[model samples]
Target: MKYIWFLPLSLLMLASCDDHLLGTTESAPCVRQPPLTYENFGLPMIEKNCAGCHSSLHAGIDRSNAPVGVDFDTWDGILLWADRIHVRTYEDLTMPPTGGLTEVELDDFDEWMRCEVFPNAERF
Candidate 1:
């Protein structure tokens, strides 16, 4: 029947109007991205990603440790090696020694290298 064809077409049109099908469900709760200060973002990321081998006590012991004179446990130490860290981690994509950095973490590192410096930030 002619009306039967309309039933299938109407059903198809109704399905397309459904919010779920259109990806229009209720909004996700908003989450503020955490600040990227050293205390908030930098320290935790380095401790999680870089410290296992780059810390003073672990350098000589961990097979993946940074070479001698490189330590990441302290802010001063990180500043000292910041350039090399920038190059190795971002430019060469050859740090962390295990799992790779996520795009989020890499963005944070790029911001830190470009925009951040401590109150007593060292020269050279």
Candidate 2:
């Protein structure tokens, strides 16, 4: 009968293993310390997460139907599509059809958008 306690303990451990179970939502505000820039943070992230389907080099079916002129290979493209990117990524959760980004990546994206993109866009 003492072994019955193991079931609830195991369930608790399993539940705690996933952040979603802890009631954390993707809408959580990002706090940037040193800050995230396009060169250091944004570019690399886009290369990894977005470029596969959103690069200009990918044409016809290779582009994965990412839409014409929706490339993110350049900072200029990113700046031009910033609002659409936000809506598609955060609000709609529809881009990056691969859904490969981790929690840390998402947080970095949030920080880059909030702290860098909107503030210094025109200057860039």
Candidate 3:
């Protein structure tokens, strides 16, 4: 009887020790954030997000060479319309018409607008 009780007690102690060794824990892979740049954020995002409806040969909304009413094909044109884009897409979330971009991508765009796109605005 003593040995039988000892075995059960030892098993319980071992289980408790195992639980302590494997305490609550979490692990997530580190995500390497891509560098924000014109090629990465500006060109690709615009091409994917806006070019379909705002490209050239589409009348007043073309975004290609002629850029319809708001040309974003050139650096100068992009600089000119940066504020409008920001307002429509970021502030109001009305552009794109399909789905909105992720907050990270939006932040990248906002940073780009503040740094490269709108700083050299002729009106500003």
Candidate 4:
């Protein structure tokens, strides 16, 4: 039937893993993560995938593509935006502006943010 095509399209649309679809920001956090620490995982992963657009300065290269006032250059800066990072990365799953990272990297990032637990139960 002509209407049958719409079924697949609707399914595809609903499959988008965005958090907004769930109607709440307080979604389930990730479990089954590796050791959680800035020195161990956060720094290296963020630097490789997020630093280009989020750092203080990167070889004086123009970074108009990224938003201003949100620097991920240091642990403190990353901590400041950790909530947003979790939202954008895990909930919305829409960040890093450009989709430069491979699927493995994205998976790793998502796992780290969600499953990776911090001491004292900190957010980042």
Candidate 5:
């Protein structure tokens, strides 16, 4: 009878001790995501932020129709002025000039510029 009780107590103690032996802790490592690409970053940001004003046939910056005069429609035009756009909209806090995206969205934009856009531009 007493032996049976000792078995359960020993098992519990062993289980608890295993955690200490393995050096288990309550904390976990944090992970962050990488940048976005043209297919993901450009289209979504343009659609949500720029399209309202700079859409096709609007204010001489038609984006939906074709690449024309700093067009945000194509990759070439976007890469052409990524820096200006980033500086003004993100860095300088100018674009969407009114209500704008949140901090995470801005960070995403910056990451995209740093990783995806600049690297490809340098290749060319």
Candidate 6:
């Protein structure tokens, strides 16, 4: 059938593992010796860097124009928006509009997201 070519083309596309289309680096496997978690590494980072604008407690003008339901005050919230967080904070490099995270923090964040948050299921 004429459509037979479509199958191979589709397989080729899938084989490319283009994660950028999803705005996530989920294709990258966790290489960190010890994975980072929300409690120890992520919470402090979010509190210091994101909560001022993205916390649930912050409302109205205090939210600093951050969209509602994007709060990073809780682990669940972080999980829900994990991809967006990765794209904005890490890939796009457009987050924390004023004060940016240090290089060390960015590295840790990249690790946490790739390993703990949006881990590549293929690795398992």
Per-residue lDDT value at 91 in model 3: 63
TM per candidate? 0.63, 0.68, 0.57, 0.55, 0.58, 0.74
lDDT of each: 0.66, 0.75, 0.61, 0.63, 0.61, 0.78
Model 2 whole-model lDDT (C-alpha atoms)? 0.75
Across 1-124, the per-residue lDDT of candidate 4 in tens digits comes to 9799999999988896553224223534555455546678878988876787888885344555667767888867766676687667655767766556666666666556544422222543
Give the per-residue lDDT digits (tens) of candidate 3, residues 9-111. 8888887762211211321122225545567678888878876666543664243333356756556666667767877776678776666789877766666
lDDT of 5 by residue, 10-50 (tens): 88888876221121132221223543677777678877787
| Clash pairs detected, candidate 2 | none
RMSD of each candidate relative to the true structure: 15.7, 11.4, 18.5, 8.8, 18.5, 4.7
Model 3 CA deviation exceeding 4 Å by range = 1-35, 60-67
In terms of lDDT, the poorest run of 10 residues in model 4 is 19-28
Give per-residue lDDT, candidate 6, residue 35: 64
RMSD of model 6 against the true structure? 4.7
Residue 105: error of model 2 in Å? Answer: 1.3
Instruction: Order the candidates by lDDT, highest first.
Output: 6, 2, 1, 4, 3, 5
* Candidate 1: stretches off by over 4 Å: 1-35, 63-65, 117-122
Better of 2 and 6 by TM-score: 6
RMSD of 1: 15.7
Badly placed stretches (over 4 Å) of model 5 are: 1-35, 55-68
What lDDT would candidate 1 get against the real structure? 0.66
TM-score for predicted model 1 compared with the true structure: 0.63
In candidate 3, position 27 carries an lDDT of 18
Clash statistics: count for each candidate? 0, 0, 7, 0, 0, 0
